[model samples]
Target: MDKIINSPYNINAVARVDSDNIVHNHIYHYCPIGRVDDNNFIYDNNNNVVGRVDDDGIVHNHSINNSPIGKVLENGFVIKENALVGRVDGDNLLLAGAAYLLLIQGNR
Candidate 1:
């Protein structure tokens, strides 16, 4: 059977992404108020929201997965392997494998 994932903010509403790696929009019955506590914004392997992130960078609330939400690094590149990774110098999320690899080349 297919697994059903629910957003921690809303049970009736669901989060949907427009493109595969582009725009991500969340549609729910009512707007979620309050801040997203890190502890409450955990996610699962299936990308389910198991927790939330508050105004401060604290993971107290419980959620699905504990993947680091928000910006992982500041003005640095996200390197997965030993390659040239894209630079995060701007306000855009770069998904280039090689580019991200290059960014963290000499950082280590």
Candidate 2:
């Protein structure tokens, strides 16, 4: 199954996560370092470990002292600093930092 990450208003697709757990947009692609599940580190196209999703659904940025950057709530909403930034459609992967990986760092 594939997960579609949409904008806050659910307008456009921000990124598409395929069955292999690889996230891809027109400009960039991010893949998991270990397994395709929780507690796994996410890497960018350059194979840099950008962030990670914890078991609690919290997204952490490795470059920023592993701070809690965002949260993937149980309701499928992606929250960043208490604001609705994006949403995941389909079975939640519980990837701690997938939204932050695609929305913020993926743009860099």
Candidate 3:
């Protein structure tokens, strides 16, 4: 679905982009994990299993057929496929790969 997630910077919302990689101005769903902990399951607006994060700070995207998107490093850098995506802010909010390859990519 062509989607765009307009979320608060700290909230870290994920969006499903279209074939052209454009994030349309629409929200399909958001980070079901309002507050993240460990082993949280990510979901779409349809409430389908999108992906998940492990306790070790690894991001796994089931939305793309069980793929390894990125991981949260010790320095609080959220790197996706070796590229610097985002990071955990002071409030410990994980923000990363929304509007790109994931709807939301983080420790959530």
lDDT of each: 0.27, 0.64, 0.46
Q: Which digits, one per residue and each the tens of the lDDT, describe model 1 over residues 4-93?
A: 122223333132212222112133222221221123333333454444333332222233244432322333333333332233332322
Among residues 3 or more apart in sequence or in different chains, the pairs in candidate 2 whose N, CA or C atoms overlap within 3 Å are 53-96, 59-96
lDDT of 1: 0.27
Ordered from best to worst TM-score, the candidate numbers read: 2, 3, 1
User: Each model's number of backbone clashes?
Assistant: 36, 2, 3
Ranking by lDDT: 2, 3, 1
TM-score of 1: 0.20
When 1 and 3 are scored with lDDT, the better candidate is 3
RMSD, one per candidate, in order: 14.8, 3.6, 9.8
- Work out candidate 2's RMSD over C-alphas: 3.6
Tens digits of per-residue lDDT, candidate 2, 1-108, equal: 777776668457656667776766622444332223344677665667767878788888777888888888887778888877777777765653355443364455
Regions of candidate 2 where Cα sits further than 4 Å from its true position: 26-38, 101-108
Candidate 3, poorest ten consecutive residues by summed lDDT: 91-100
lDDT of 2 at 106: 43
Which candidate wins on lDDT? 2
